[model samples]
Target: MHKILVVSDTHRKDENFYRVIDIEKDVNLIIHCGDTEGSETQMQQLSTAPMRIVKGNNDFFSNLPDEQEFEVWPHRFFVTHGHRYLVNMGSTDIRREALVRGADVVIYGHTHKPVAAEIDGIYVFNPGSLSYPRQEGRKPSYLILTIDDEGELTYEIKYLELF
Candidate 1:
């Protein structure tokens, strides 16, 4: 199986970043949903796997793309920081954009809340925030996605501390 690590909204804090990197070293792909707060350079150095990072609203100094669409062979993903999509209000904007882009899945981060659900023939996911979480109990978190050779996909949310 091929594994992918997904995280977002670090906001310049990286206490749990290395921990995730160490635990998921077997995974060669990492996706940052943005709001890194100018920590791209450090994240790049510490990442053992190739990383795809977007530009969040807070990433004013960075020139990363606002959104990205890529494939893992048979699986297409739409990734964005979500401000353009108005994620703080809801996922409608993202849903519409994902559909237009012909993506199988949408990965985004903006609300600092962990979300995982399949909506309207598409998969919508948010890894929450690794440094700051706004969901119930407020525990930092991230996500792990695995794709089998047969193209089957599995996902799980791993929190820094048990809620």
Candidate 2:
């Protein structure tokens, strides 16, 4: 089985992000949708697992790509920060882009809102923001994606408890 950690919008704050890295120590891969705010290098080094990170709107000086595509056996993922795709409006634009890219999954962050759903056969996910969450509970959140031996995927959303 392959375990993956999906997180985004840290905005340079490492407290929660680092804590999560420590907690999910067994993750096989780490995917940062975007908005690391220049902490991409440190974030990558925090975990032994290979990381895939993209540039966010707040990352003015970052060198990361605007979008990335990769495959985990039968699943193809499209990763982006969501700003260019107008995520604030809805997922329509990004979904269209992902369809054009031939991806079965789309991971993104920008609205600082967590979303997990299947739309027209495409899996859409967002881990929200660890530094500044805007969801209903306003808790730092992330997604755990697990791919079993048969390539079946399962996902769960986790929230960090803060005092």
Candidate 3:
């Protein structure tokens, strides 16, 4: 089984993001949807797992790609920061782009709202923001993706309990 951690929109304040890395120490892969605000290097150093990070709207000088596509065994994932796709309106545009890329799963972050749903046979997920959350209750959130040996996929959205 492979465990993947999905997070985004840290915007340079990484306290909660750091906490998540500590909590999910055994994750096999780390996916940062975007908005690291120039802290991608430091964040990458915190985990031994290979990481895939993209350039967010806030990362003007970053060299990361706008989007990335890769395979984790039986699943193909397309990762992006979502601003270019206008995701705040909805997932329609991004979903179409993902379909064109032949991705089985599309992951993005921009609205600072967590979403987990299967649309038209494709899995759509956003882990929200670790620094600034816009969802109700305003909890920092992330997503845990698990792929079992049988190639079945499961997703769970987790919120940080701030004290």
Error of 3 at 31 (Å): 0.4
Q: Which predicted model would earn the best lDDT?
A: 3
Cα displacement (angstroms), candidate 2, residue 70, comes to 0.5
How many pairs in model 3 have backbone atoms within 3 A of each other, for residues 3 or more apart or on separate chains, i.e. clashes? Answer: 0
lDDT of 3 by residue, 1-118 (tens): 9999999999999999889988887799999999998999998887769899999999999999999999987999999999999899999999999999999899999999999999
Error of 2 at 88 (Å): 0.8
Structure candidate 3, residue pairs in collision: none
Alpha-carbon local distance difference test for all models? 0.90, 0.92, 0.94
Clashing pairs in 1: none
Alpha-carbon shift of residue 33 in model 1 (angstroms) = 0.5
Measured against the true structure, the TM-scores of the candidates, in listed sequence, are 0.95, 0.97, 0.98
Ranking by TM-score: 3, 2, 1
Name the runs in model 1 displaced over 4 angstroms: none
Residues 1-163, candidate 1: write the lDDT tens digits. 7799999999998878878898776886999999988898899988988999999999999989999999986788999999888898889989999999999889999999998888897788899998889999898889998889898878888898633
Residue 17's lDDT in candidate 1? 82
Candidate 3 wrong stretches, greater than 4 Å: none
